[model samples]
Target: MEQQNWSLATYCVAPHVAGTATLQGARLTDFGGLSVPIHTSSTYKVDSAEQGAVLASRKGWPELRKDGSTAKDEFFYSRWRNPTVAAVAAHLAALERAEGCLLFGTGMAAISTSVLSAVKAGDHIISQSSVYGGTFHLFSHYLRESFAVQVTFVNIEDLNTLERYIRPNTKVIYVESPSNPTLRLVNLEHIASIGKKHNILTIIDSTLATPINQQPLTLGIDVVVHSATKFLSGHSDLTAGAVLSNSQDFLKQVLFLQQTLGSTLSPFDAFLLARGLKTLHLRVSHQNNAALKIAHFLDTHPKVKVVHYPGLSSHKDFHLAQRQMSNGCGGLLSFELLGGREDGRKVIEHLQVINLAVSLGSVESLVEQAATMTHSQLNKEDLSEAGIDESLIRLSVGIENVDDLIEDLRQALEYV
Candidate 1:
C-alpha cells in the first residue's frame, strides 16, 4: 500500500495533526525535520515551458494533490505564492478552522486588498464606528474618495439605527470585535444574521480576540481577518495580516486582488510567522489569564473611572462575551483615568514593566492613550461616537506575572 513519490510538504501536513504539530509546518523531506525549513528562492524552477505556463496562471491557493506532482506549483515566481508563506497560511487556516487563508505583508495590506475585492465602484459598505483607526480611515476616507463607494459608520448596539443605515446597494458589513483601544464587543451573531437576511457579506476583524479567544466564521461570518502582528506573533517581532474564509469563490477573488496589489509577504517573515505559531497557544493562554487579573485590578482602583474587559462581570457585554469567547476575555483591556488626557499620560509615562507605546499584543505589556496616538484628530464628540474617550488608556496585557503587572500599574496610577 505504498504511495507514489510525494512532495515533502503534503505528507507532513496531513489531516490528523493539530496544534503545535501544524504550527511546526510540513516536513521538508522524506525524513521529517522538527523545524520548518525556509524557502528563500524568489523564482522556482520549472522542467518545461508547459510547467511554467501552468504555474504562471496560478493565483489562488493550490489544491492538495497526492499523485506526487499534481499539486506542485513550484515554478513561476514568489509574488504569486511561496512555499514558506503558503505553509504559514495553511497553519493559520487550521487554527482558524477555515477552508482557506491568505497572508500579506501587513495588517493594513490584508484589509485594503480585501476591501478592494469585496466591493465595486458603486457598492455600499456598512461598518461600525468602533474599529481600529486605520480601518476607520480606510472605509471612511480612501474607499469613498477614490472608488465613489458609499460607506456608513453606525453604532452596533443600536441594531435598529444600524439597520436604517443599510441600503439596497450595501454589499458588505465590516465588524471589528473587541474593538481597537476601547475593547468594545460587537455581537457577531446579530451582524451575521443581518448580512444573511440582506444578502450581504459579513467581514469580522477578529485580531484582538485571536483564534484562541473566538471564531467569527463559526458564528456565520463570511470571513475572518487578523492583524497577525499582535497576539498571533506574540513576540511582536514580525508584522503580518491574514484573511480566512470558507467561500472558495470569495477566496479566489481575493487571491487575484492580492497578486495584483503585490503586497506579498516575504519568505523570511513568513518563516518567522511559522515559528510564532508554535507558541501561540502557550502565549495566548497565559496572557488571557493575565488580562483578566489586570482587568479585575483596574476595576477596583478608585482612580480608574471605567475598565473595559468582557471577562469582568461589571462589563456591559459579559453575557455576550461568555457566549462568543470560550477561552477568556483576551490579552487586551482599556481603562479611563480620573483626570483626563493629562492624567492618562502620567499613568503611561510611569509604567516600568509595561512600555508606553503604540501597537500591542506583545509579550511585554504596552500602554498608550488612544486620543493623542491611535485615533485620528477628533473632538470629544467624535471620540464619544466611536466609544473612545480622551482619557481612555489602552493596555495590552502581556504574559508577565500578574502580581508584577499589578504592582507596576499601582505605581503608574499613583501619578494620576
Candidate 2:
C-alpha cells in the first residue's frame, strides 16, 4: 500500500484527536469551494464479510480497556455521525474553544436538551428573567409541566438575588447576556463564579453576542449555546443551533440526549453553518461597526425616547458590557419610539431596506416590535418587568453600508 501524506490543516484543526477513527484533516479545497457536498446516505457499506466482522468487533470492544488496545470503530450510520456534519462540528468546537460541540435542529432544541440532560425531577434551575420569550416559555411552562422541574427567574444584575433563589436541588444557572429584546448585559464572570461556588452548571445563550464577538467558555461558563440560525448562518438561509462544552463528560451527556431526542441537525444544514462561520470574523465586525453608528444616531434623535444598546453610555449595562465583550456591543439593539406602540409599528412599516421580521442576525437589516413579535406571548406586566415596552423596536443591524442603513432609519423615524 502506498503511504498517503495528508495536509497539516486537516490533522491540526480536525474535530477529533489525531489518529482517531474520525477524519483528522480538513481539505482546504472543500472550504475554498465554499460548498461542502452533503453526504445524504443513510448508511455506509462494508468492504467485505471480514470487514463487517472486524467492524462489529470494534463496536463491541471499548476504545479504552484492560486490553490496552487503542482503536475506534468506523462509521456505520448517518444518525450517529456524518463526515460533513462532523467536520463542521469540529470547526465550531474550535471557534467556541470547547472540547466538543453538537448541532441541533433549532436553538430551542439545544436549550431544551441541555436543560433536560443537566437537571432532573426535583432539580432546580436559576435563569435570567429577561430571556428570549421562547426560552422563558420553555422553562416556565414545558419544563415544569413535562419534567416536574423547578425554575426561578431572577434579575441577572443582582447576584444576591440569584444566590437567594438557589435551592439545595439547584443544578443549573443559565443567563443570557445582553438578553433578548432588552439589551441588558449580564456579568458572565459573576454568574460563573456563583455557579462554581454552588457546584452548579453555568450555561449562557451566546446568540446575541456571537463567538466572533464573545466567547463565554473563556469566562468560566460550563456550556455555551447559540441559535446558529441567527448569526452563525448569517444569511437567514438555514435553521440551526449548537451547544459547546469543555467538559468531556458533559459533552457526552449532551450527545446522548441529542441522540435519544433525535434533535440532530441535518448534514446539509451543518455544512451551511460551517460555510457561514468562515466569514463570521468579517461579517460580525461589519455589523458591530454599523450597529454602533445606528445606535448613536438613535440616541440623538428627538423622536427616540430611549435606546437600549450596550454601545451607548446612557445604557444601564454599557460599562459592564465594555468590561465583558470585546470588539463592540453587537449589532442588535432596541429603542423606544417617543409615541409608543403605534409609533414603533409606523417606523417598521416605513422602513424600505430593513425588513419587519421575527428572527435577527441576518445580513439584511431587520426591525421588529418586540412586545408584539418576539415577546408577544408574555403578559403586559412581564413585558414591563423585562423592560420590553410596547414602543420598543428591536433592530438587527446588518452588514449594509452605514450611510444607507442610517438613511433608512432616518426615513423610518420620520414616520414615528
Candidate 3:
C-alpha cells in the first residue's frame, strides 16, 4: 500500500486516530472546514468487547500511542483523554518545545497541579516574592495549611538571597518572570542552573511572556506553566491553563494528578485555546510593540513616579529581559502615580477608552489600581515588600491604536 501524508486536518477529521502528534502545529483553520470537525462529542461508541479491552489496556492504537503503535484500543473516556483536548495539548507541547502538555480549567489549576504533583509534604519550595495574588495566597496559606508544604519567597534578582532560602528539603523552585503587577523579571538560566545544582525541579509561570516571547524550558528550566486565560486566549473569551515539561516521567505524574484531581479543561475550552494559540505569535508581537511605546510614554510623564517595564532602560531587569526573551518585554506594565493612591483612583475613574478592569491580556486596553484590585489580598507590609505602591496602576496594553491609547492615558493622568 502507498503511504499517505498525514496532516492535522487528517488526524483531526478521524479523531479515533487521535495521535499525540496531531496537536504538534497549527492544524485547525479559521473556517469550520478542515481536517477535523469539532468533536463536540462527550462519548464515543465501542465496536466490540476485544476493542474495549484494547482501549483500556496500557497500549492503544497507532493514533493514540506516542510510539505510533498500530495496536487498536486506547481512548476509553473523555475525562482521561479526549481527542479534542489531546489535539490541543499536543499542539501546545510543540509550541513550548516540551515533551508533553496538559490542559486545565484555569491558570490556578495548572499551577496548583504542577506544585502538588512535584512536591510532597515536608518538601520546600523557593519562589519569587512578587507573584500573582492568587498564587501568593495558594503558597502562603493553602499549601502551607493543607499539605504542610513550606515555601520561601526570595528576591529573584539576588542570587545569594535565593540560595540562602533554599533548604535541604527543597524539591522545586517556582517563579514568575516579569512578575504580576510589578513587572519584575527573573533570570531563567541562572535559576535553572541553581535548580540543577540541587537536583530541584524548576517551574516558571510564562503566562506573561507567552511562547512567542520566551521559552523557559529551553533555558534549562524543567517545567513551564501558563494561564492561557491571558495572552494565549487573547480575546479573554476562555479561561484555561497548561503545563509543559521536557521529562516524560514528570509529564506522566502531572497528567496523573490532572486526571485524579478532576481539574481537566472542557473540550470546548480546549478548542478555543487551540484557536487562540494559532494567532499567538502575531498577537504577542503587536502587544509588545504597543507596551514598549506606552512604557516609554509613562516613564517621561511628569505625574508618573516610576515605570515598571523591562522594556524601559531604567528598569532593573531590562538587560536580563533582553537576554532571555526573544521578542521584547511584554504587554503588561505598571506605573506609580505621583499623587499616591488618590491619583491612581482618579486615573482609573477618568479613563474613557481604557476599561477599568481586573484581568488583562485582551484586545482592548485595560487599567486598574493594583494595590486595590489585583493585589488587594496582600497586607500593607507585603505590598510594600513586593514593590506594589498605594499609587501603582497596572496596565494591560491592547492592540488598539497607539495614538488613541496614549491620548486616553494622557487625559487619565491629567486627573492627577
Report per-prediction Cα RMSD to one decimal. Answer: 3.0, 5.2, 4.6
Question: Whose TM-score is greatest here?
Answer: 1
**Candidate 3 structure, TM-score to reference:** 0.90
TM-score for each model: 0.92, 0.88, 0.90
Runs in model 2 lying further than 4 Å from the true structure: 1-35, 46-74
What is the lDDT for 340 in model 2? 86
lDDT of 2 by residue, 1-416 (tens): 99555432344344433122112222323344434557777777867877667655444322211111112234455666565666677667766667677788899999989888899898999888899999999998888999899988876566556788888999999899879988888888888888999999999999999876787999999999999999788999999888888887787778777877889889889777767776776788888888888999989999999888898888888888888887778889989977989988899999998889989999988889999899988999888767788999999988888899889889888875
Summarize candidate 3's per-residue lDDT along 1-416 as a digit string, tens digits. Answer: 99765544334323432223233343444354533235566666778977777766635523322221111134567766777677677666666666667889999999999999998889899888889999999999998999999988875566545777778899989999879988988888988999999899999999999877788999999999999889888887899999988787787788778878989889888878877776676777788999999998999999999999999889898888889988788889999977999988999999999999988888888889988998899999889777789999999998999889999999888877
Clashing pairs in 3: 9-35, 12-36, 13-36, 23-90, 23-91, 55-74
Candidate 3, after superposition: displacement of residue 342 in Å? 1.4
Q: Model 1 TM-score?
A: 0.92
State each model's CA lDDT, in order.
Answer: 0.81, 0.79, 0.80
- Pairs with steric clashes in candidate 2: 10-25, 10-26, 11-25
Clashes of each: 0, 3, 6
* Candidate with the larger TM-score of 1 and 2: 1
Ranking the candidates on lDDT from highest down gives: 1, 3, 2
Clashing pairs in 1: none
Best by lDDT: 1
Error of 2 at 64 (Å): 15
Candidate 1: global Cα-lDDT? 0.81
